[model samples]
Target: MRPDNEVLIVGAGFGGIGAAIEFASLGIDDVAIVEREDDLGGTWHVNHYPGLAVDIASVTYSYSFEPNPFWSRLFAPGPELKRYAEHVAEKYDLTRRMEFGTSVTGARWDDESGLWTVSTADGATRTCRYLVTATGFLSQPSTPDFPGMDTFTGTVLHTAAWDDSVDLTGRRVAVIGTGATAVQLIPEAAEVAAELTVFQRTPIWVVPKIDFPIPRAVQRLFARIPATQRAVRLVNTSLLEMLMVFGVLHFRQARLGNKAGALLARAHLRAQVSDADLRRRLTPHYDLGCKRPTFSNSYFRAYTRPNVTLETDGIGRIEPDAVVTGDGRRIEIDTLVLATGFDLWDTNFPAFEIVGRDQLSLGAWWRESRFQAYQGITMPRYPNLLSLNSPYSYSGLSYFTTIEGQMRHIGRLFGELRRRGASTFEVTGEANDAFLDEVTDHLADSVFYLGNCAGSHSYYFNHQGEAALLRPNATLTTLRAMDTFPLDDYRFH
Candidate 1:
């Protein structure tokens, strides 16, 4: 297959957009972007449910290169975030290279020609010298296969694919699952619905969030002098990075911080709920770092209202118009909401076939061997393909750091590639093995493995009981690796 473009990015999310903009700045303009959705923003455009907002501080969540000085709130909502993403797409002229509604179906690398032949769902084909897959792990919406999900027929809604058309003002609402998404949407659901019932599999640790509106004066100052916003981003990022290092990666140093955070959580719970049993039901049983902690000031307080009910008994089955608990108790409902998150493994790289050397599918390689990559970018036997947001690549706190760090690394790598006039390069098997070994060896000291993930229901560990999702490195350490790591570890030809 002949090469049609220099680079092809498989998503239009933050990572993809960041890649496009960075490549453009590096004078690589022969790029093409393919998105499956009609719009540009990836998850932000799809998830428009009630009370949808970022949990991370807005100051550090945005692009480091293009910080928005006029964020209305410290925790920006879904609409504003979608707008910000669209604004970046327009600002960088990224839409000119975008092919929306075109989902990539398959990609095959031709070792002889040194190009990737990518096919789409629309029966079209294009080839590129490099393929950058930025498809996020959480892009797919997962619907729990209840015994009678097709039987109820009520207005069923997944938080990822929320339907605002159904009026919840006077309807009985029942929400299932109490993960991060459920915590964010539960408070708002209790407000508008006539009655709200939340089904929880397990209690999660929560801390009070200090979200507020950014005053106009501060916005004016940020716009007038961008240095102020940069400083804020830097300070908050440094503090939050500790959550990754001391909190999750190295649990030994997390003793003091965990005690302080737990004290605050206990105080918040005590102050919010009056009933002792209810407080006990709401309180988490595991350590803070066992699972992904959430930040919400109102989740605990929402149950204090008269219209809300918390159900802890496990689910048995679903009837035509109600849910049956394990003890044979039936709870009637007008709507069923599923806050169940996406299948992290199924949608890891989208439903596509990627054939590498020896006609081996990337999916089969992982299923047969293990989930790994060289610094979460390149893998052995897959030449000229970069998988961003793969296992052991997340920044732990701020995704912006992950995005910026990865984009800079990829840009620098290709810069070196073009300068040397190399047709292709692949990570050495020894290098890939050593890198993954280092990550797994460090897991002994991390909270995910050492402290335990039993009943945590976290996506951090795979089915093999291996903690392979998050990187155990500090933020600055990852930045240094991305910036100055030796290219000799890879085979450039």
Candidate 2:
């Protein structure tokens, strides 16, 4: 197990799995995928909470290479996604190349040898010519530091790390946060809980989800006629891409378009909920596309339930058996669920600390909360290291699509390396700075900055209040930029 490897992939999510397959296809057999969990699906395997599902349509969420013609619903749930990952792994025989329960602690570049020395939690050390970090942006959960959280008599669980054994059949449940996960879980919990109280920090814009069962006949047709399925996927992907362009480049156009979208969403809420006050509270003051828009058919209807209460007052503290609001009001609950989202920008330096050429640590470079990457793949001083779904790589469309594009970009880089007989390659500092300047300038006019969205923290932005996460365009533009193997952009050894 201490043998040298060609490439080391430090995750088993969709991105990591895709990298493994791509590397295998390149005739690189010494590739290894190390997953901390027991299975291949990273987020899907961990977050097994109630009413967990994908927001994107099922067809678009899947990998482009291997299409699944057996999706049961437009929005697939967590279990089905996990099964899909497993099926892909089995089909590609990726399980044999993966080492489960092995967490990457840190990775350091050997300056003399131009190789990465990776360390694992199990005290195993290995060196590889190239290191691929496929750890996803949404992989880590963000659990707020609530005072007296440990002393609470009732159980508390983050939605991403749900404790299923704690039954909520007849319990008084209190859900904290009103993000996408909260909207999805509230409706399901309202059906079984004795009473449900949703604590909202800031109201979110939610649109009606047109989620429906995809009939077996349609699945059969998709299987029989691949052209029809491909056509549907192409149309959906293109529409989303166009919407992203409108959101980023054409602000006036996006604002006008969002007004209609907002009116439709608000009207749907008004029609679903009878309480005028509740409907007003649910209506978002900002534009629809400012924050990540959610889709839920029952979220508005759930607020109308007799046993459910939506509280907009901020939380003060957590009492023994109750939650205290900022206005000195307390609501008692039997269980607490934290639907707070993931830490996208937080630094989780895996045990192997990455040190670049000048003995500079990646942590040190990003200490001021500035994330800089050349095309979100390679760093300026880091040679032979690739990061999938890194900073500025997240797209408005499906993440799977972005990851596929990045994997292809990396694949092309590897081909260029082989053709040139280069042992190591790194982007020049001038090129990296130029790319970052362009990205920051593009983000300045985007909706995340110009929109009149209040109380929204810049998770997508860095410490400098610049958007460092989302990509400007959709699949075609992104892939086109990545398609050109720009060997001139980097310095080779």
Candidate 3:
């Protein structure tokens, strides 16, 4: 394939789709979206496991510009989300500009040509003036390297990359880990599996999902009156923000901070499960907000089922068709499901190499110092390169809002470049360093640091025990910061 577009976007997730729409709205037609999967909806297309759904309510989860008043439920399922993504792509005519089953292996910046050279896994090469990486944080699945995993005769799968062909009906199933994915899938699997065993390394704080279907009449009302829907969205967003603030600022204020959340979660557990020991096992030991809190009405209830078993004894290793526990106990199973989550902070990519200015690799740069970007979009050395939902860009609020913010930021930068007639625009070293310092200082006062909570090995925190996954503020703060591109903060040439 030849170089065919001015801008190349990798991954067809929310960020990529948002970028494409934003650019298209700005009358930039020479854009190409390359997706590794055969279809759109990057993570939604792949993760088709049982009970897969968005944790956030559908109203805020969707695109703000293109509101879906017809959402089936408060928290939409994966299939519905995938269909919504496809709908957006078709509605905005993005499908024609997208190349399916095209995986970008590496992207290198050519200084002389002032363009990006992108290489695919199939040895096909293409070039573009700008490269936007939207390879979402959860795009990669982290399958634990269990001993004798390959030797297992039974089917093995990861929740993120679930195999639909493998039937769980009447089959003995063993699920590893009790993270978000496992919490959702375990309930569904327990209903079908003849015998189900969940091996939980640590307990997770569970809250009621409070999900319900949006009636057709309500959908019609929202469609007829958009302001009403916006009002509802604002209300929900405000409530969540207040909760986050309370959890962060007053964490140690006795019954006001994490204690309140813990009490609510304990009450929820009591209401859901009848067994006393099971309820105790389900209660979390750590601070409620230290890790991502799981929202589920059925997860704890699933353990009350006759066939389902919750094993708190940590796994020692995998022995063929059984999971050996640390306490000399083993649970035999015919299928193993690993819900170990993704390696979000592990920026290692051996197969792909990105050579920035002065032959500096992005991996090497991030390793030397943590990943730093101006507005989480542009790095100092990588000119004309933008990363959507990059490090320190995630939010407790919906990710769609963050993607929109980044897209706007990129659009403003492109506008600035076009108006100034600048061929290449790169963030200055001084500006990047100053921004990093500001972000670091802000993070120090945030909940990730001030909360009376000891950290664990979560995707939210990197190896350095710093919360690199999420931005420590509301969506409005991020949008205001990136609403304009400060040309003075960057170098032109």
Among the numbered candidates, top lDDT falls to: 1
Q: Which residue pairs overlap in candidate 3's backbone?
A: none
Alpha-carbon runs more than 4 Å astray in model 3: 1-3, 249-255, 274-276, 347-352, 452-455
Global lDDT for candidate 1? 0.86
lDDT order of candidates, top first = 1, 2, 3
Q: Give the TM-score of candidate 3.
A: 0.95
Ranked by TM-score from best down, the candidates are 1, 2, 3
Q: For model 2, what is the error of residue 420's alpha carbon versus the real structure, in angstroms, after optimal superposition?
A: 0.9
TM for candidate 1 is: 0.97
Tens-digit per-residue lDDT, 221-332, candidate 2: 9999988788888887776776666755455546776566678888888879888898878777776666777789888898888999999887888988998887889899
Which regions of candidate 1 fall more than 4 Å away from where they truly are? 349-351
Model 2: runs farther than 4 Å from truth? Answer: 1-3, 348-352
* Model 2 weakest lDDT span, ten residues long: 344-353
Error of 1 at 63 (Å): 0.7
The candidate scoring highest on TM-score is: 1
RMSD vs true structure, all candidates: 1.4, 2.0, 2.2
Q: Write the per-residue lDDT of candidate 3 for residues 1-493, one digit (tens) a residue.
A: 3355798999898889999999998788999999999988988898999999998888888888888888899898889999999999999999999889888888888888888999999998989988888888887778788666767788988888788898999999999889989888999999999999998877888888889999999999999999988888888777776666566433444335567788899999999888898888877766677677879999988998999999987777787788888787978899998988877766422224677878888877776878667767778888988877567677555788688888778778878878888868899988888877877776775556766456344566777677666666666777777786466898876
Count of clashing pairs, candidate 3: 0
